[model samples]
Target chain A: MAKMNMLQAINSALAIAMEENENACVFGEDVGAFGGVFRATSGLQEKFGKDRVFNTPLVEQGILGFANGLAAQGTLAIPEIQFADYIFPAFDQIVNETAKFRFRSGNEFNVGNLVIRTPYGGGIHGGLYHSQSPEAYFAHTPGLKLVFPRNAYQAKGLLAASLESNDPVIFFEPKRLYRASVGDVPEGKYTIPLGKAEIVQQGTDITLLAWGAQVEMLEKAAEMASKDGISCEIIDLRTVAPWDVETVSQSVIKTGRLVVSQEAPLTGGFASEIAATIQDECFLHLESPIERVCGLDTPYPLAHEKEYMADHLKVYEAIKRSINY
Target chain B: MAKLLNVDNPNNTSKNDTLNLEFVDEHALAIPTFKMLDDNGELYKDAQASSMDKETAIRIYETMRFIRVFDERMLAAQRQGRVSFYMQCLGEEAAVTGSAAALEDKDMIFAQYREQAALAYRGFTLEQFMHQNFSNEKDFGKGRQMPIHYGSKGLNYSTISSPLGTQIPQAAGYAYGQKLKGDKACTICYFGEGAASEGDFHAGLNMAAVHSAPTLFFARNNGYAISTPASEQFKGDGIAVRAVGYGMKALRVDGVDVLAVYEAVKKAREFAVENNAPVLIESIAYRLAAHSSSDDPTGYREKEEEETFRANCPIERFRRYMLKQGWLDEAEDEAAKEKIKADVLSALKVAEKVAKPALEEIVTDVYEDVPLHLQKQYEQLKQHILKYPEAYPATASRIEETK
Candidate 1:
């Protein structure tokens, strides 16, 4: 095991993918010598050579379309959209082409060998363009898998898993925790399976459900809620689409109360999907209607960023309301 | 002013500094339509003679012949309600087969449908074709795609997608990967003039040129894209000139001339690999049949226009060329067509009788593994189907047997 930040762990995972599979390639804007905008791909070009790790022209749609083709050739094509916000330009390619490559062609052709990695969520003063949590948009796509990592350890394992899986994956890296979320990650390959949720801390009163950066917030909120003797069970739902419903529903059934949190807006957020499903699964057991602590229904704000956030304070308040009810 | 190109823009730069009213119309940038064979299947007076091997030439013609008969029979099957839908590459056989013959078998092909002949040229068997179009259990796609949306990993041909021009950028990326691997192979992306209008076309061509990717972007300017004509599709000089605009080598060729297409592609592949660059080739042709089975040509085009192109069918043009060179006999050629027609019919009969893909295949291959939600839903669906025996006739009996 080695002490590494989220960026280092992710970089390490990409290196392993390239070294393990000769067909694996990493390409995106400024990803070559510059090592990407966040330096998450730093030292990759030198280590892997410009062929496997290189820069592409600044066109998101082109990047994905090309990656889709490369994946069709059975190459492990890892294309990075610089930010999740800029992912919209390639949304048609992702949703229509990559998502449907396998199903539409039956099983003969697929972009299953493709993984799109992009930094998401807010904390830096990126205002609107860089801060939006776009997981909800991709979660709606059926043939795609969505995975996000909270810290360095997970960032390494989850990314390795996403790379190896014969399913198209969109890995949302939390830009906020690139340097902050440090941990001792194993040097080599390890995988946390897709569509499986991780239970951070077990409790009985209520379950705090979130993923990626939101999972970090839930942990802090759970800690504060413990002061009031509200034993909050925290879960990091690693996979968003085709989520770990069995684990989450089981937790909800036991706890009898749930609070889902996210960085996206309240309306039609992934939290809504969780709430609706959990209510049906554990309807008789639920003591109170599941509370949702999510961003306000607006574009991610610049000046009033804290107000727009569904931070620990907000999640703790929601936890309190659920327990009291 | 002198930073680049001795002035501002490559298009607007002039020697003298003066305000002038000028406009470059379509005529000013007139694109030369490449032609090799005349009405008698003889090379044009000024056309470059090709030193193509007899064996390669015969192989191209044979694949072209195979597709010609296969397309006609399949379209008839669609008319008879045997298959759900079918798209025929009836008139564009030479264009597809010649290009396929030009490339190494290992080179990747990203086809925008209608290039089934390319698959045939790369040794996709008649049984494989029947399996795919029949959507039987033997079909590699497992009855998932519509008929004719064929794919083969072994052949290096991408599975066909109905979406237009999406394969353009994919070829650019795949070719770049090949270039990086130091593989002498390149990628050939096929699309119609109609698909070239898609935004992916622009993005793909620009990216390929900028990144020095070795890709051959082949546009079959087949007179129509579904119901729309090439004239209505765009205002520019066909598709090849756009490659120049994107800073890549470009070519325009007669889609009916098999030898011309073969020679052009051979040189283009060389240029692409030697320089690690892309080349765009526009093959001008006419769709003798409707855009697809669903389309009606009488609604938009006249019989006179159809007759004009039908008179120049790619299969006939190539056969005549083969006969002129004494490479084929008229009697043997006619006999071969008869055998091909019978073989296709026999394959169709076999394909029609094969069982449909297993019901479980429906929920499979969408992901590497089905998650809990899908498993539950599938279980629920199975129970529902098993319960309602009479209503779900096709599936009930199978589920009952499994239970």
Candidate 2:
């Protein structure tokens, strides 16, 4: 085991996957000699050769369409979209063609081997253009599987699992935690199932649910709540689409209170989906209404980003409200 | 500065250095339109050097004839209320069939909806075609797609999608995979002059050129994209000129001449496979029929133009060329058409009568294994369908059997 950041974990996972499977390839803008803007793919091209790791034109639609073509021909394509905020150019290709290939062809053909990797969410002062969470857009799509990893360990494991899956996956790596959240990750190959959750702490007063960077925020909030004589159970949802609803619901049933947090806008965010599902499954067990600490319904601003983000204080407030109620 | 200055030639006072400026005429880049066969069904004297074998020529002619027959019969069937929609390749048969005939069976084809002739040339049987159009259980696409959206894994034809130009970039990526495999196979993407307007067209071509993927982009410039004619589509020369901008080889062929299209595509396949490069071919043809059974060309075009194109029909031109080579006879051609019509009619009758796909098929294939959510949704749908059996007799009867 080695202490690594999320970027290092992801790069190691990609290298391992490529070494294991000859059909696996990596391509995107600046992913070759430049090794990606964030260096997530720093030494991949030199290690795997230019044939396996290469750079594509700065066109998201073309990048995804080419990936679909490669996947359709039985090649494992791991295409990076640079940033999740800039994925709209290729949305149609991902939504209509890649997602529907198997269903439309009646199982005669499929591009299920392709995985789209991109960094998402805010906290790096990227402002509106670079910092946005668009997971709900893909979660609404039926054929796609959405995965969000909280830290280095989960990033490596869940990414390995996504690459091994037989369905197309949209993997969102929290850009804020790429270097900030470091952990001891295993060197060899490992896989975490797509819909599993990890319980960070065991408590009974209230359950704090979050994913990606919000998990870190909730961790801090849980510590503060513990000092205030209120115990908070924390569940970090590693996968977003086919989330581990059973885990969250079971926790909510015991705690009888829930506080969900995310960095995306309040309306129509994935947090709403979790909140609604929990309420439906554990309505009678609830002692207080589920509270949400989320980004306001506005574009991520440059100067007032702290105000727009769901910081630990917001989570602490939600935890206090849930416990007091 | 006090004197009047010539705006055409700016006066420089600093250094007496001369800067050469020359005017280049746009006409220097003339787009050539290639034609091998004349209107009278005779090969041009200069075009007699084509190296086409007798068997290949005859197969090309036969495939063209089969597509013509299939299109006519299917259009009539649509009018007769047997099928919901149909798109005919009335005048552009030579473009699709000739290009497809030139490629090996292993070479992939990513075609638009109207390139049914390409599928037929690749050995898609009449029964398979009918099953797809009829949306029967036997259809390869499982009745999920609309009529004529054909796909066959065995034949290497990518499933056709309704969205224009989507297959272009996909073809590039597939060709890249073939290149990596060190296989001599290439991918041919078929689209229209109108589909060339989509942003995917630029993206696909640019990607193919940048990656050195072995992809042949065949643009059937058949004048119209639905009701919109080519004149209103773009002011540029054609789709072929755009290849130069992408640093790729391109050719413009007379789509009416099967031998020319065949020769061009054959050479293009060689160039792409040998160099792992992409080539673009713009085949100029005219749409002799409506865009589909639902359209009426008279509203947008003149009858005289239709008559003119009909006179130079690709089938008749190819048949005359074959007759000159003593490879075809008038009586044999007539008999072939009659047999194809009979076979297509029989296939349609049998396929349309086949059972609708099982209701459970709707929820299947969404994933490798149906997840719990989809299974629950399917169960709910089954309950709803069973409650109204009379309204959905075909679906209701198949629900229990699928389970």
Candidate 3:
């Protein structure tokens, strides 16, 4: 095991996937020489050669469309959108073509091996253009799996699993945690199966559910709640679409309260889905209405970014509200 | 007089080299449309002839006739309410069939919705086409897709999508894969001139050129996108000139002439595979049918204009070429048409009577294996459908079947 940041883990995962499978390749704008804007693909082009890891024309639709074609041809394609904010240009490719390829073709054809990686969420002060968390947009798409890893350890494992998956995965790496969050990730290959939530902390007072960078915030909030003699269970939902509702429901059934936190806007976010599902599954056991600590519905702001973002304070307040109720 | 900023600095001055500047008149930049045969079935003098053999010429002529017959029969079926929707490759047969004929079996085809002629040329059977259109249990796509959106893994034809221009960039990537494999194979992407207005067109071509992907971007400038005419689509010198901006080779062919389209595409394919580069071929054809069964030509077009294009019908032009070559006889052509029409009708009759897909298929193939959530959703849907048998009689009836 080695201590690594999310960027390093992602780069290692790409390299490992490419080393294992000759059909695997990576492409995006500035992914080659520049090693990606976040350097998540640093040393990849040099190590894998330009053919296996190369730059593409700066068009998100083309990048994703090409990835679909590559995957359809039995090549494992890892195409990156520079940021989640720019992925909308390729939304049609994901929704209409990539997502529908297998279902529409009746299993005769599919871009199953395509993995689209993009940095998402706020905290980098990237203003509106760079910091928008659009995981909810893709989480709504059925055929596409949405994965967001909180730190290096989870990022590497989930990414490897996504690369090996026989389905298109929209792997959103929380840009806020790219370098900020570090952990002891295994130097060798490991995989964390999608749709499995990891309970990072154990508590019976209330359950705190989150994914991506919000998991860290929730962990901090859980610590704060513990100081107030309020025990909080933290469940990091690695995969948003096929989330481990059983784990969450079980946790909620034990705790009798739920506090879902995410960096995305409260409306139509993946957190809302979790909150709704928990309520349906464990309604009678609930001690309080499901609380959601999320970003404001407005665009990610430049000025007073902290106020616009959901931090530990907001999550702590939601925890208190749930515990009090 | 206004003084030029930084005029005293010689380095800041603009270079005035009019002598070296060569100007191309806008008219000169207009693509030269190619034609191998005239409307009267006469070969144009000094025109380049197709290298196609007599057998191939006869095959192309028959395929065109088969498509025309198929379209006529299917359109009649659609009107009869036997099929939900249909899109015909009426006058644009040469644009699809000829180009498909020119390609090797290994080459991939990424087609727009109207290229049924290409599928037909690639040995997609009448039964297959009928099953897909009828969306029967035997339909390869399992009734998930609409009519005319056909695909076959064996045929190497990517399934067609209703969204315009999505396949254009996909061809580039598939060809890039072929280039990586160092295979002699390439990919041919078909779309209409109107689809060229999409951003994907620019991105696909630019990527193909930059990556030196072995892809042939075949644009059938078939007059209209639904009710919108090509004249209203762009002011440039058609879709062919746009290829030059991407630094790719391009050709504009007379789409009514099968030999011309075949020759152009054959050469384009060779160049693509040989140089590992992309080539664009713009076939200027007319939509001789309504955009689809959902459209009515009278809403936006004139019968006189349709008749003018009908005079230069691609299938007729190819038939005339075959007749001149003595590869086709009038009696044999009529017999072929009758046989195809009969076959299409028979297949339609059989396909329509076929049962709908298994109700379980509604949840299957969403993934390799249906996850638990989908299983639960399917179970709930089954219960709901069973509860309201009158509203979902077809589904309720099939709920008990093991298949």
Please tell me what DockQ candidate 2 reaches: 0.01
True contacts kept of 1: 0.00
* Model 3, C-alpha of B392: deviation from truth (Å): 2.0
Query: What would the TM-scores of all predictions be?
Result: 0.57, 0.57, 0.57
Q: Tens digits of per-residue lDDT for model 1 on B213-306? A: 9999999999876545676567788898898788899988889988888888988999999999999999988888877775666655789998
lDDT of 2 by residue, A1-325 (tens): 9999999999999999999998799998657755776788879888989898976654578789999999999999999987898788789999999889999999999988999999999876555556889988888887998888999999999999999999999999999899987999999999999988889999999999998888999999899889999989999988887889899999999999999999997778999999899999999999999998887655554333544578787788778777787
lDDT of 1 by residue, A1-325 (tens): 9999999999999999999998799998667765776788889888989789876754577789999999999999999988898787689999999999999988888888999999999866454566889988888888999998989999899999999889999999999999999999999889989899999899999999999998988998899988998898999999997799999999999999999999997778999999999998999999998998887655654433544477787788788788888
Reference-based lDDT, residue A104, model 1: 92
Which regions in candidate 3 have their CA more than 4 angstroms from the true location?
A: A1-325, B1-28
Whole-model Cα lDDT per candidate? 0.85, 0.86, 0.85
Per model, the share of native interface contacts recovered reads 0.00, 0.00, 0.00
Interface RMSD of each: 19.8, 19.6, 18.8
Q: Alpha-carbon error at A70 in model 1, in Å? A: 38
lDDT of 3 by residue, A1-325 (tens): 9999999999989989999998688998657755776778888878889788876754578789999999999999999987888787788999999999999999999998999999988886455566888988888888989898988999999999999999999999998888888889899999999989999999989999998888989989899888999999999999998788889999999999999988887778888988888889998999999998887555554332544467787788778877777
- In model 2, state the lDDT of residue B261: 93
Worst 10 residues of 3 chain A by lDDT: A299-308
